[model samples]
Target: GNRAEQKEDLRQLVGLTAGSDDKALLADITLRRASMYLATADYEQAVKQAQQATALVATHDNKTLEARAYRIWGRAQWQQGRANAAKPLLQRALRLATAAKDVLEQAQNYYDLGQIAFLNNQFSEAQQLLHQAIDLFKVEDDKRNMIRCLDNLGSIAILSESNFEAALTYFQDSFRMCQSIHWPYGETYVLYHLGNCYFEIGDFAQSQETLGKTLTLTRLLGDRAAEANALDTLGLAYQFDGQLEQARAKFEEALAIHDSLNDRRGKAYVQTHLGILLSNLEEIEQAGIYLYDALSARSDSGAKETTIDTEAALAWLDMARGDSDFAQERAQEIAAWLQENGTAGVELPFQVFWQCYTVLKLTGAAEEAQSLLQLAYTQLMARTQKIQDEDLRAHYLESVVYHRQIIEAFEATTR
Candidate 1:
């Protein structure tokens, strides 16, 4: 907590110093402070500083500095949930960098584009962009941003497509690069990502072990946000491993940190996950209340995707309460929203399938239920079929149970 305050103070000092300085120095200081903010995950402040830096460059007329400033500014904007605002700025930066023949700056611009694509859940596009950035980085001998790009690619592979093995391979390569460069923060970042891949693959044991180390390292380094993230991931592993008590503890701790730090999105995420665990324990009313709160929080935080998920949870709760009509209504609402908005990745599809399955089962439409199940299974398998192996195959078993439950329910209804 004390360290967090101290870091904020440093951030303010840097911002003030950069704003008061002349063009060249201001640009340099702003970029440096933007890097600091990125490390601290204070993306809003990073964007502010980057914008300030870009404003200064209009007076100085330095294309290279302007390009770099725009790239960083665009990244910060994307991270701050303004991807549309980021797009044109990043495109301008890329064009400027290319025109200036600044290979490294051009590579960094590509790296930022990859990040934007990843955030928008464009996995294949992100991979292609990141690979291009990596090649550019190698040509320019820029190992640092190259490794960062790799980590981003790894994250997309894990979360967007559930390609855990590919994600792990990327993390391993990133870890090797971080080790070769003796980058402490980079090492922790890679470890955290590796843990996520392991978690997604159902290797809770490895996830727990790696994330435990990451938590310790982040805490020792006084990185509050990173520590909170690691704790949250650890909590998730516990949740999936059926360690409800431990999961609750970890989640409570993480929720406290997010609340204290005023991270609304983080709070919403933990609240939703904690609500799920509570529901699993048959604490339905309490879970419903929490899930509703989580839904509102997610909406306020502009986490529209998570808001949809919490809606699905509410639908599930309604079904569990024997309120089939309400559940069906909510499920239809979600499905309509998903179709209109065209969700970027698999999560939206997953939520849609669950809702459709629930509605079909509740209405005693056995044929439609089986059809939806087949559709979901076919999509999931098609997306991940090539990626699964013996060790990772069990991860898909959850989907199987979901299908089985609907079939069983439909059979019971017919009887």
Candidate 2:
């Protein structure tokens, strides 16, 4: 059943069992309700229900059920942006699953932990954990979760900055697996990933086409959140391709949907995109409003990483307005913040590094800009080295705009 129907069914089940003496049945029903809440994006309610289920199961000897309760609770916590709290709960759940010899549950804990690791920017750890989950899922022939593993593996591959080719391979592998399993949800999501991949690889036409297909599938599945996500992404494709009006329309549409759902995070993302578009169009003051709103929204959501991304966009606007001092100050502050926080190996896809480098250079901070350029080139080459195919590697180095920019900046500055 769809997420909405599943939620309603689980709610009815809870009501039906309200006076039951069977603690186990009630606990199970409540846990299912928690899972439904999660599926419907009611993170707080999911956490509360999962906690209730855990308490109800505590007096029983059902280790598996207790583990499921913990797992659901952990997932709800992660969705609620409490990943630190989610980690230990997931670990406890994993231990229980292992003790109970429940392979699937163990695999699930690993997958969730991997996701948390990814969110925490521990890319290597995330990769290793996801690999473990994939192996266990293979043992159970769980094609559905196997697709998820592949999708996350793709994300891990690309999150290092470049390696879009590697990500593309994994996403395509997942798309094929989804097709084989007739999993519409996975298929739709993977297509959305592919559309994003195409956009990042400089295939705007293909990006638009793929995302258009994603939009159709999302609508057919009645997944409004996913539809809004697609619209935002498609809007990005248009914005980056210089179709400003179309991009604005798409962003406005996505923002309206997000507002209706009270999805602050989603709205922040679209706002950032619109702000960038507006800045590009030289709507300086109004662009600043959108960008600052996005920054505040993301910061309030505890999305530190993407908040830095919005900060970078704000720097872009500062640059556009010839406010070199302000741009330089933001760049330096953020650069220092990343260093202080020990957030390594994360070149935010928002071009934060490039933006910082440009502002520093323009503002006569040559030493700092040169240092950043050298580091960026080093990272770019590191990503380039991973592409084993000569043609693809050459294309990435030569054709990808940012890659080329870093290389040129390095050469111009150093020589």
Candidate 3:
């Protein structure tokens, strides 16, 4: 039977047992139905079934089943972006699983907690928790959970650490395992991350190709969120490739999806990207509008990285408008904030530094411009050295040369 049919069958089974005296059987059926609902993204129905199961098993001896119900309910909440509401439910599930000596459920609980940590940008804690879950899943020979842990670890490396080389290794391993197991879901997720990694390393062609595959799979799976995410990344790939029109289209499409889903975080991210693209296209007024909106949305969502990026784009916009003094001040403020927060290793600050130098040079502050240029050069060199891939390293070197030429030209003009 198809998934919908199977879900209906489970629901019917639950209904048939509604008048029976077997509370355990009723609860078990409800839990299974809840899981089916969760898998299909029917989170409200999933929560309803899980709550019913939870009430049924509250005073019962079926700790394992109760744990399963709680876990499913927590997953539903987490999927809805209610991480705070989900955590205590997951913790309760973990306690029940531990009391019942259910290693599988315990592993699942660890994975859930690890996902929460990852979302909160607690990379080290996420790694530790995911590793523990991986060890337990290995012991149980649970290939699916193992693949999930590997995928999450790859994401942590990419998003949290910007360690693209290590992230690629993890994704490749996970992709191979998914292929071996015929798990298209996991394969699609790996492809998405692989595309993101490729984009980060300046491989626009490969990134676009991989993200295309991800888009196809997400559409086939009817996963709107994943489809939107793929579109956003594809837009980034196009933006980096200088396909501005295509990039704008993709961003608009993703924004529409995010709006339909009421996903404020997704909307903020797309807005930020669109703003950057508009800035690059010299649409200063529109760029500023988008950037300011994105800045507000990102601040509300607590997306620190994107908020910083939006600020940098706004400063760049100021520079484009010949407001060198204000641009330099804004860029320096952002640079100081990044440094004070110990977030100076990322590419955003480097970009901001370059803008600051440009502003200083334009305003005839040659000495200050030279100082900023030297600082940017040092940071770029350090970052380039950490890039293990030869092609990516060459890309960074190219950027360094371009920046050096600009500095040289500025110096000559000042002389």
User: Which candidate number has the best lDDT?
Assistant: 2
Q: Write the residue-wise lDDT of candidate 2 on 1-415 in tens digits.
A: 3666666676787788888999899898988878777765666788899899889989988889889999999987776556788999999999999999999999999999998988778888998999999999999999999999999888777775457878999999999998888888888889998888777665677889999999988877666677888999899778767688999999989989887766776778888888878888898988898899888887774646658778878988999999888998998887666545533533344266777788888889988877766666776677777778776676566645666778887887666
Stretch of 10 with least lDDT, candidate 3: 342-351
* Index of the highest-TM-score prediction: 2
Listed in order, each prediction's TM-score against the native is 0.81, 0.85, 0.82
Taking all chains together, the TM-score of candidate 3 against the true structure is 0.82
Q: Note the residue pairs that clash in candidate 2.
A: none
Error of 3 at 374 (Å): 4.9
- Cα lDDT tens digits, model 3, 1-415, are 1455666688788778878877788889888888877766567788999999999998789999999999999988777656667889999999999999999999999999887777666789889999999999998999989999998998888666557778889999999999999887778789998998787776788899999999988877667778888999999889877789999999999989887766666777788889878877888888888788877876764546547767777777888887777887777776566545644223345556665666666777777767666665655566566778887776544533344554464456557
The true-versus-predicted C-alpha distance at residue 67 of model 3, in Å, is: 3.0
CA lDDT of 49 in candidate 3? 95
User: Model 1, 189-297: lDDT tens per residue?
Assistant: 8999898777766678889999999998888777667788888889988877778899999998998888766666576667777776776677889888778877887
